[model samples]
Target chain A: MSTVRVVCQQLAPRLGETEHNRNLGARAINDAAMLGAQVVVLPELMQSGYVFKDRQEAFELSEALDGPTLSLWKSLAAELDIIIVGGFCERLDDGQVANSAALVEPEGRLTVYRKAHLWNREKLIFTPGTAPPPVVQTAVGRIAMVICYDLELPEWVRLPALAGAELLCAPVNWPDAPRPASERPGEIVRVQANAAVNRMFIAACDRHGEERGIDWVGGSVIVDADGYPQAGGNAHRHEQRLVADLPLAQARDKYISAHNHVHQDRRPGLYLPSP
Target chain B: MSTVRVVCQQLAPRLGETEHNRNLGARAINDAAMLGAQVVVLPELMQSGYVFKDRQEAFELSEALDGPTLSLWKSLAAELDIIIVGGFCERLDDGQVANSAALVEPEGRLTVYRKAHLWNREKLIFTPGTAPPPVVQTAVGRIAMVICYDLELPEWVRLPALAGAELLCAPVNWPDAPRPASERPGEIVRVQANAAVNRMFIAACDRHGEERGIDWVGGSVIVDADGYPQAGGNAHRHEQRLVADLPLAQARDKYISAHNHVHQDRRPGLYLPSP
Candidate 1:
């Protein structure tokens, strides 16, 4: 099995600016493709920037499945022969909006996963999706998509991992927070932990720049199966592109030691049925 | 509620030296109490050391709940008016041996937890526990114990978190593995993630020393609710004592943001019933 070249394009998105954000996403994807990225990921809400003032504003900024941003992404995936995974604000029926991610394969297949676990004021603005994260089989590998806060939930990440996902691509808008002077951002740390525990590769794309008085960590990272970052594991706080060659086949081998396999060692019956 | 002073004594235990191990445990407990630690944590297999040659050797080193090491710990807890948590080789029914940890309270209450998930060669020697980790309400806080590799499973960690454990004390004997020079150990990273996701405090005590040609990670850490290490988050391969005054009350408030509580935000209905 060969390695897959994955890229995370971290860029700043203007609030409520649909066209500008679409252009930004396009440029990033083009840059990543130029850098030989077989799979490219963008930050969450790449279509309509994060931090909406209210539900009405979010709904107004949301777009349908066939919206211009997704259409452009599909066209780019086909034209560049690269898998495109990105986040968008979705306009659902009944006047509700959802924070969602779209994974577009070069073959023109599109799979969308709505944010299942809402964060902060998202609970007030967007209707949370009750479905699990989707793991799609692309030409490169078995890739999965989840939004920002969804990565915080290990059980949620386990869904795709258990479903045989080799790579989990997370589009995150990590609001900047105080951490130790010499420490990595907690958001990136959690991503590393998630990947390491499941023996899966994870690429998390975080946005930068201040939007409506809110800042981001801008901590994009591409971690291998062993949970070490191959590229971009710091809080650079700027528009940056991270690329890494991941042996997705390493994720297929669940064993970490001679007597232990990451997945098969789980004693699910011992876990509480519900929390 | 006031802060609880916790200590993780990362020490070495010589294999098959029962008497010497007991003396080492006693000295560590006394030293921790002298440093004003309300709760003390010790490494896994602290009583008999890790890396048994075979099942017979492990059984020979195993002890019951009334064994000398635990008896000494009980005396220390009562005498110093502090809680003590540590691991030991447990002798079980049917001529079996198990890797277990004991949480001894100042009130003379003893709670034992067998490791549910074995690591590497341990699968060949010990019987895996069928029960979940035990959470005990001590005078300082609601403390829980789970040995070594059990911490790798998010589901297992969630059991104690959901059971209202404020502080989870882990006795881990992490074997040294090749990691990036600048990156933190994956074991420590997972501990941070577990604490952050559950909004709980975790003190994992790891050992150091070369045992039967197997070196240990000696990465002991005390992490707060936000998953930042309060003390001793490094690969210090020697005898070290990590102390941190944890505001256990912070764990009670599970809210990371105004609209999100870590536990309440969980969508259990969507997760796979068994995996």
Candidate 2:
């Protein structure tokens, strides 16, 4: 068993700055690769900005899998022998657009995952993802990709977790939520709980700055199977790129103790009956 | 929709002192009823006290549903028009014993829900519960019951939330775990996340104090459907009964925004097919 070094890049992207945002993502990827990260994750809409003006502006910013930004990332992933999971505005056939994330592995395999649960204003511009999130087996671990608001839905993560997803990569632009005083933000609690329940490692990269009256939470976290942060995994109020070694083998141990097994103890028949 | 004032009683029980523990529970119930609480919850194994010595000892501490403690509670429920949910060691026929929570409604209906996932050392003495957690319709709201470790399983809570449970009454005896510095304990995170994910309110009553060299975490919390604590719902260390007004109507608001519905947004085919 080997430890997969995971990096979560908390960077703030400019609105509608496609080329410049791509450069920022590339620099973060390069730095993470230099630091020996096997998997590097970027914030949501890393290639374009969130807070879209209109559908036409969104189309102008969107890119396909083989387009310039993804093509550059694919080449970089192949060259560095690392996997890149980053969010982008996606342009598909017949004027369809989505908030999506592209997963490029070292073996030159690329899979695009769209955001399933659209947030407040994104429903006006991007299409809500229809396909299930993809779980890809790689040298580092079994990885699953989810765009921004997808993390909020339990089924979105629970489904992949049951399918043996070891690592959940989330690219998020979390707007400020009302948090209780002297407590960790609700987003942090949400990730840790989901990670602990499924016995999987979750790496969520959140944007760190304000955009058009929308203030980002700026909290990026990577929680282990026990729902606790590994060293250098919990960061807030800063543009940080932190890496932690995730023990993939431990995630396979859903048995917290001899009697309690996280996954096996689930009464799925009570949740949803089996076919 | 009338408000159901829910009370969580956090207090320590004496080991091997069934009469004393029942008296303590009665006092807490008196306090809660005086405070206008319609539903009062108590900690897990409130009668038997956790950390048993042997099987014979556990049996000595166990009682049937018609036992003295439950009869007292039934009379009190009828007298006060308040519902009581509390944990006790259940002694069944044929020398079988189980860890169970009894829900005594104001109408004299008693439902016993066994502990599904027994913690360490408990598997040695008690029979693990087989039936799914039940959701019961009450005058004030739809209620559900689960023991301590059951809260850790997402399916345990998610099922009832989907079944339209508004208030989840949990009788927990949370032992202290290794917590990171300046961070809320992992137990708090688990409850809040599950509550928010299912769009339901959860009120957990945990025990406070040490018993036979084992220390329990005494933080009792009642969180709203959105996962933030209601006013006066967060109580730590000390023998206290806290009450919060639960908006039962909001738990039915699975609709987070105009487009996103927590339960409706599920892609079950991707998880497991429905029968």
lDDT tens digits, residue span A112-178, model 1: 9999999898988999998888778888889998998998899999999999899999999999988
Per-residue lDDT tens digits for candidate 2, residues A86-196, read: 999999777878999989998899998988788877878988787777789888778998876777777677777877889999998888867667656777788888888
Recovery fraction of native interface contacts for candidate 2: 0.61
* Window of ten residues with lowest summed lDDT in model 1 chain B: B266-275
Interface RMSD of 1: 1.8
User: In candidate 2, how many Å is residue A23 off?
Assistant: 1.1
Could you give candidate 1's per-residue lDDT for residues B168-228 as a string of tens digits?
9999999999999988998999999999999999999999989999998989999999999
lDDT value, residue A248 of candidate 2: 79
Instruction: Please state the CAPRI-style docking class of candidate 1.
Output: medium
Which 10-residue window of candidate 1 chain A scores lowest in summed lDDT?
A266-275
| TM-score, per-candidate, Cα-based | 0.98, 0.91
Model 1 has an lDDT value of 0.92
